[model samples]
Target chain A: MQAILQLLVSGVLLGGVYALGALGLNLIFGVAKVVNFAHGEFLMLGMFAAYWLMTLTGINPYLGAPIIGAAFFLVGLAFYAGLMRFTIYKPELTQVFATLGLSILLQNAALVAWSADYRTIQIMPAGWESIQVLGAYVPTNRLVAFLYAVAILLAVLVFLRSTFIGRAIEAVSQDLVAARLMGIDPDRVFLMTFGLGIAITGVAGGVLMPSFYAFPSVGSFFVLVAFVVVVLGGLGSIAGTILGGLLLGLVETGIGYVAPDLKEATHFVLLILLLAVRPHGLLGVKGAEKETLK
Target chain B: MIEIRDLHAGYGDTEVLQGIDLDVRAGEVVAIVGANGVGKTTLLRTIAGLIAPSRGSITAEGEAIGGLGAHRVVERGIVMVPEGRRLFPRMTVRRNLEIGAYAARARPRLKQSLEEVYALFPILREREDQLGGTLSGGQQQMCAIGRGLMALPSVLMLDEVSLGLAPIAVKRVYEAVRAIRDRGLTLIIVEQNVGQALKVADRAYVIQGGRVVLSGTGRELTNNEDVRRAYLGLTEHA
Candidate 1:
């Protein structure tokens, strides 16, 4: 029983990072209706940014999260202004192809600059401290990361609910034409939203560095997980992504204990099953199909 | 205050609006009536700047606004309530209204505009907390109109406000139209319900195959034999 409880705790902690990663992707997709193929690259770039900052300046990764986040936000804005603007109003195929091309370009660019060797931040304190809860040991870094995730999620939720610009994002997500008629420049909203989305990944990368390794292709692995979480959580629903992340974490962890080799297979199988059962996802709004299309 | 002369517009190769000419005077309510594929909605969309015109000029207050984007046209004080009552389904009624005031020019008077919109549709104020998607068709139409009014526009254009609504709901929408017109805003309405549109409009135009086949005072268009036979289905009675 203690073993089961330990697995559950660990799963929940991992789920927090997954949730954070999925949140930004879902927000950008929801509002802009563009599936950012380069989303994973942003995560990859963020982790590298934090890693380099810590190595060069000796700034703690945790303390440098906001700085990295701000830098990524600016980078995201430039990415949108430079490449995304031309294809935003075009056909869906154009958007998909353009972003996919960007993803390829970014991956190669990282390879040329940083090389393919895996690297992990070697913090002095080493973050492996654990706490005993209900006879289960939990890592302190995991706990801190979970708390950080929750805080960011809450802040994002409040931003969406309380601010004028946030409401415009929601509005554009629902109906682009209607939003435009309301005097929102969809281009400007898209640029800001894309920046905000990528910036969250930056913060998530900073939080994750102590617990995970960094590599040129590290983002590719987790980006798949994030996509799974986003779809399982119901495309554009923020709260749904959080729940989906948790559910996926638990499922993956539980299955890994039973059959470690089949853990990845189990995740994909469960995703397919859930989609077949509920096309719109568990918490998705009915008739919200339009949110998925541009 | 709005004029379109020799306008041509389309989606890709096929033209949806061809050589359309019309004028709407200040404080006048103009209605355009036509069949489903006759480009009634496209005409309104062109004027609202959703689709750029291929040729010709659209001038509001004697300034050319033919090819401006929808957001720019909105900044110029033209607003549209698109067909099918397009509301932000997941957003609360209040948020929808707040977004309606997104234009910089409308931001200063947002409070006054909100009050006016609430006055025009008191039910919106009552259901402000409800999700927009949950509203009934009639209520959604009301919300769409209310959202347009929130912009405090100089020219308000509504496309198919009466579509998919019951007769009583149609009456309520027309009443709102009359109230809007009474406020001295230039209004352009595209509707399939010929009788209801003519009842409130100052002038009417009949579009067919993307061309203005006929146009006159609302009463004159109502009495015209061709319009009556084609649009109003009055030939059977005649």
Candidate 2:
């Protein structure tokens, strides 16, 4: 029973990181209807940024998150303005290829610059790596990442509900034609959404640096995890994302406990089954998936 | 005041509005009536800057705005309540109304405009917290028009206000239109429901094949023999 409880706690903590990683991708996809194939690359860049911030300036990643977030916001703006603007109105294939090309470019660029070295940050001092909760041991870094993820997600929800610009973003996400009639420039909204999405990812990357490795190819792994979370959560639904991540985290941790080698296989198997059974996801609006990709 | 001279516009490769000309003065309820597929919608869409004019001049208060985008057109004081209510279905009524005032021009008067919209559609106020999609068709139309008003438009345009509604709901919308006109805002209404549109319009234009076939006061056109024969589907003096 203690074993099961420990697994559950670990799963929930892990799910928090997954949720944070997927949040930005979900936001970009929800508002802009762009699948953002390069999302993983952005995460990779974020990890590198956090790594360098710590290595060069000796600032803890958690403490340096604001700087990372602000920088990534600008990177996101440049990504949209310099590349996405041209292909935003094109066919879905065009967007897919465009972002895919960007992903490849970024991956290669990181490979050239940082090489294939795997790096990790030891932020917590000696003998303080794990914390006790409910008579179970949990890593301090994972717990901190989990708290940050939940807090940021809640903050995003509040902003969307309360602010004028946030409401405009929601309006555009719902109906572009209606939003235009209401005097919203969809282009501006798209630009802002891209920036905001990437900015969140940067923060997620920074927070996860202590627990995870900072390697160029690491983003590819997390991106797949993010896709699973997003697909399970429901496309374009923030609250659904949290649910999806938590569910996946628990399932993966349970699978890991039973058969460690088959752990990675569970994500694809579950994703395929979920897609077949509930393509709209756990809480996605019906037909939204079709509307966005098509 | 607005003027469209020799407007020519269409979707890619297919011309819809060809050589269309129109003039709408301030404080006039002008109805553009036509059969389905006769370019009535195309004209309004072009005027709203959703469709760029291929070869024409659209002057609003003497400033050319023919190829301006929809957002820019709204800044020029034109707001369109589209064919369908087109409300953000998931958003609350209050959010929908608030979004309508998103234009820079309307943001300053958001409080006043919101109060007026709520005053005009008291049902909207009562259901302010309800999602837009949950409203009945009649109530949706009222909410849509109310949203347009929230933009603080000098010239408000409504496309097919009576598209799908019961007779009582139609009457309610007409009464709202009367009240809006009484408030002294310029309006350009396009309708296939000739009777209701004519009842409320101060001036009327009969469009056929993207051309203005006739123009006169609402009462005059309502009684015109040609208008009766063509649009009203009435047989010439049997």
Candidate 3:
């Protein structure tokens, strides 16, 4: 019974991490309709940025997040202004390969500069890395990341609801022509969204770095998880992301508990089933998937 | 005060608006009427800066605005309520109206613009919280126009406002257009619906094959045999 409870707690926490990771990707995809293949790379870069910031400046990732967020926001802008701006209006395939190439370039650059040595920062006190709660041991870093996810997600929802620019972003996401007619600059909205999305991704990485390793190819792994999460939750549906992540987390945890060897296989299987059975995702706006690709 | 001199534009290679000359005086209801696929939309789109003209000049209040981007054109107070009543479907009606006041010029007067819009279309006030897509066809058109007015536009260009609407809905929309004219806003209306466009228009232009074949007072064109036979769809022919 304890083991089952532990699995449940672990699943919820794990889902939180995935939710945070997928949020940025979904935001960019929702507004710009650009599926960023380099999303994981952005997260990986954030992890490294946090790691280096810790090692060099002695600033904790949690506390130094704002700085990382601001920097990544600029990187996100450059990503759009320098490269994505050109590919965005092109064929969907062009966007696919462009982001893929970026992923490759970023991974290689990180490998050349930092080497493949896995890096992690032990932020929690000794023996306190795991905290007991409801008869389950929750990793301290995971709990912290989960809290961040909840706060950020709620904040994002509020931002989307209450703010002018946020509504403008949502406006652009729905109809570019309509947005333009409203005097809302779609290009500017895309720029802001990319910046905001990448910034969140960077912060998510920094917050999760203590729980996960920071490596050059780390993004490749998380990118798949993000894609699964985004698809499963319903692309462009912000609230739906939480449900999707939780479902993925629970299934994976359940699988991991019963058959540890098949844990990784669950993601792929769920992705396939979700795509085949319900392409729009559980709560996604109908035909959202078609709107982007077509 | 918008002037188009020999405007030439098109979609990549095949030119659509070939050396078309048109004029829209300030505070006038000008209508551009034509049959289907006659580049009516293309002309409005070009004027809105969705497509840059290959040649010719567009001057509004003495400022050239031929090839400016859509957002830029909007910033200069020329907003187009596009064809198909392209409301942000998922956004609430209030949010849709709010987005219309997104430009720098409109932002300052957002509250006033919104109130004006709600006053113009009382139905929008009731539908404020409803999703834009959920509104009926007529309501959506009004919301689209309300959104355009939210921009505090110096000149409002409406593209096919009556298409796909029921007769009563179309009448309501034109009534709203008349009310907007009473508010002293310059309007450039594109219509395949000839009679209605002419009725609201102070001056009307008859466009054929991408060029203005005829221009006169609304009554003059309304009474013309060519316009009557070609467009009014009154006299049946084999």
Worst 10 residues of 1 chain B by lDDT: B229-238
For DockQ, the strongest prediction is 2
- lDDT score, residue A262, model 2? 92
* Worst window of 10 by summed lDDT in candidate 3 chain A: A285-294
**Deviating ranges (above 4 Å) for candidate 2:** A292-294, B236-238
Error of 3 at A58 (Å): 1.6
Candidate 3 lDDT over A166-239, as tens digits, reads 98888888888778777777778889999999999999999989999999999988999998998999989998
Q: What is the C-alpha lDDT of each candidate?
A: 0.86, 0.91, 0.91
In lDDT terms, how accurate is model 3? 0.91
TM-score of 2: 0.98
DockQ of every predicted complex: 0.82, 0.88, 0.77
What lDDT is reached at residue B190 by model 1? 92
Q: Give the alpha carbon lDDT tens digit for every residue of A1-294 in model 2.
A: 899889999999999899999999999888888898899999989888989999999999888988999999999999999999898878888989999999999999999999999998899999999978788999999998999999989999998888878887888889988998899988899888988999999999999999999888888899899999999999989998999999999999999999999999989998999889998799888887887521
- Give the DockQ of candidate 2: 0.88
Model 1 lDDT per residue over A195-265, tens place: 89889988887788777788888878878888788778887889998998898888888888899999888
Candidate 3 lDDT over B153-208, as tens digits, reads 98999999999999999999999999999989999999999999999999998888
Clashes of each: 0, 0, 0
Encode model 1's per-residue lDDT on B71-173: one tens digit a residue: 8999999999999999998888877887898888898888898988999999999999999999999999999998998888999999999999998998898
